[model samples]
Target: MRDPRMSAIGKGLRRRGRLMVQAVSPPRRVAPERRALNAVPAQRDPRQEAPGATPAPRAPRLVDSPVFVLSSVRSGSTLLRVLLNSHSRIRAPHEMHLRTVHVRFSRDFTADAMKELRLDRQELEHVLWDRILDLELRHSGKDVIVDKTPANTLIFRRLERCWPNARYLILLRHPGAVVTSLTDRRDNPDHAAICDEVLEYAEKLEEARQHLDHAHVITYEDLTADPERVTRGLCEYLGVPWESGMLDYGSHDHGRFRPKLGDWSSTIKSGRIQAARGADASLELPPRLLELAKAWGYPVD
Candidate 1:
């Protein structure tokens, strides 16, 4: 039987059945008298209470055409990022993780106060993210900035809303490869959970590829196979001259490659673009994964 307490949280799952699994702490015990007080609804934010509240104006964006690389984890985005970072005019820094950085409305009037200044929680966070990108661009002495956070694929729509003029690089890999990579890297790997995660990312990647006006699709297999050709095309899309140094990214300083920030494996440290591994045919793929593999032009048979 489902716990009555988790009923509200269960509603958070999308109708399509995709869920980002998270650990939920057990409910805490409360005194009998306190339970009644806790039952009282919290005060609604002013914007929610106001009837017919029009859309609030937003602050101008700081970095208009910042590039975003949308890919699943272990999809070779770090490699793409470093190559771009090696370019003279592009700065691809460690994951800024703008989604994790947020603004909170503590007081009931906080929303009202921000609305007066043409700001809301989301817009304020966008401004802060833009400022961070601007700062990183200045530090790198580069004219263009790119964010290649793997998790960014989950929030591609929000990112597009934040920067309407943003450019996207939809990086793809074989679903079987993604599942194999994640399973090998995680400590206590759950194959079921891993496939679910890969599917979530694959769905979002496909959505972004279909929705975005300026999305450039690239595959991990092709990236390692012919980096010079792929990167030259990327440079052309980014409106920058193609520099041969980008092909030899090993010669550049692409910041620290550590856990959480990016792939810190020996393969990346070797300062070489190694060939991507083909899918593990021995491992059976889920139906959805098989579909995506075929959709992305990979042989699933």
Candidate 2:
């Protein structure tokens, strides 16, 4: 038999010869039809960290990929949602009211509804976020989703823990007006006591500021007076392109939430400013509320 050493040398030489042939040969030109199918032209989406065409090594986390709009109730969050919804890539909810009622009502709702609704404690914390992203993909056929819930601003610290990459757009209305709007009901006529609710919101907001890193605040007055400028600033902050029609969200019919059968529905449909700059002047707020506003950096005028 041939020596074992000789056999190994011949095998190595044969492999080298094959490699040399490959290096020297002219590449076979692909047919026109084949070339078209094979070509992958360079395309980019600045909003996406990577093009959807690229396969991620692993699935991204739910929280890491969601956009959240956080603020107190009736603080121009509806307007913000309208603007954001105008974007081709964004789908938003009108008022999810998830945080306020989701967790708070978890125990009250029957365990059967809880199980059937798919809202456990963890899911409740991120209900609007989950629904916005999932529905945008299904209905709006977009990847970017806007969760424009006002109470989210107060409870974001709890949310941030679950979704560190959650982005926030804060809506800051005049405290007096916010309280006025909330406390205007005939049964809820305790104007001074309403300060407790406003103070609680401020306390939570301050806590959110201390704990969360990815947040920006926009005042309601600034938005109404210069919607284009404010909306553009918000887009820039979120690394999105600003579109002009975002100012006209009052007309878009996403049909997410139906206002109750009452003045609330009529008021929302009217799209008029419910609270003006001096709306609080006619109402009597407790001195404690004025003090709380002053302490929280809200002008007491």
Candidate 3:
């Protein structure tokens, strides 16, 4: 027979070991609904749900019919942006380069990757543009938004694919003048490369005009020569009443200049719309650019 005291001690140790094991063991999983209910409500929150119940679904996001100002750089896109922004219902912001963002997304466009992500090419592109435009509209507290990304002309097809109802304002400037402005800002003396860029931009713009049904052409020369007349026409195209104050863009706050977006926009800071001086007569245009200018309705001579 075992000693009584030793038997008691053995029983005590067994009980303690059992208690320790239970303490360290993982707890049972709570249901998803239960977990959601227990989550701490965010600060100043109004919504509340019963414990162990599903929360209400959120409302779908609203995206406005956007107006795009498409053009090549140094072609008066910035000036037009300021003029539109001055309008009461329109909020035109600086270049947001949505096309660049779309290009980045395209890198991962393989079939398998898209399947894994649960989004097709069009779906992904739509989501990106929608989110950007929605944020801009909310921030500006405006009913209509105008985005002026000069390179956007190159991606008009893609934009149409995403926002079929979106309207476009295509701004055209003399190719020679555009290149002159571009080269003036940079130290690079290679006029050939700059000319090539201008021609490519014009080609894309022409293509967009041909394919898109809702595009309106606005020449930079005409815009500067008669601000009121050009802007009134733009308002008619946009289906909004033209505001007289739009002519005084200098009085409105267009926000600070962003150097990274493009330094060519610095002229808008002058607070007044100046008449467009003729392009430097001495600046010679490459043969390709000269031909493009003539085709686009700008005189080469």
Candidate 4:
């Protein structure tokens, strides 16, 4: 038999030689697809957090009970907003588009860093949203602030999550009228796409009206036909007394009426509480539109 010591030495030499060979070998080239995957960071959505992780404890908000007006585009939300802003204790600014604001974790360790502070990406965004509401309320010298972004209808659930104590105002308009306004205002409007958009908002609004016990529902027709009664009820719902001055919104400084920020059409800029144009009864409605309208108590005939 060979010497046991020589055998052990030979094994050690072989292991070291293999290591030296690998060290000198060129690094393996990463596949193109793998390199591309590493180049782009994963998108982090506020709605989606790591599964099975406990949500952070709720933090106190400076503006705890802010109001959000949920409605479809061209649904007279701007009219409602201006009317509310006219009140002494209420501040309703142009579309804040808070839903569009987002946060990104550029570094792999950043999310973990935030986790140490008892906050996730969603919680951080909630804090930012709360700060925005508080800042606007403070600046306006108003006790209550209302955000009348019509797009709020799309992400109402997220808003509710961010502000559990938040109040909601559901604004509705005849589906026909919304469709008409969209087609008229938008150049080369896609009729099918417009209907889809209206249906999407309507579905969400109906869901909200059904689900939220504290929500106040209003329609464009009722608001224009009897401003006093409707606004008095609104004041009651919002814990404020009726102010006759709210009707004469045209006389108040409601900031600049402009496009994208909110409604800026000549009709809205007129600052007059004009009667809502009656939707054509002859206009044939899609089955979904008819269904939603009937559900909301609008006449289908």
Q: Against the hidden reference, what TM-scores do the models get?
A: 0.83, 0.63, 0.73, 0.83
Q: List the residue pairs that clash in candidate 2.
A: 71-150
lDDT of 4 by residue, 36-110 (tens): 212333468543465787887777888889999999888899999989999999999989978666678877888
Q: What is the C-alpha lDDT of each candidate?
A: 0.83, 0.61, 0.74, 0.84
Cα displacement (Å) at residue 239, model 4? 0.5
Candidate 3 regions off by >4 Å? Answer: 1-61, 102-118, 262-266
Instruction: List ranges where model 2 is wrong by over 4 Å.
Output: 1-63, 100-132, 185-188, 260-267, 271-277, 282-292, 295-297
- Residues 184-284 of candidate 2 have per-residue lDDT tens digits of 64353556545666666666765665565667877778787887888789889877788877766666665644442112445456654343343467776
Error of 4 at 132 (Å): 0.4
Model 3 Cα lDDT, one tens digit per residue, 216-251: 888999999999999999999999999999999889
RMSD of 4: 12.0
Q: Over 4 Å off in model 4, which ranges?
A: 1-48
**Pairs of colliding residues, candidate 4:** none
Question: Looking at candidate 2, what is the lDDT of residue 81?
Answer: 72
Q: Can you give the lDDT of residue 207 in candidate 1?
A: 83
| Higher-TM-score candidate of 3 and 4 | 4
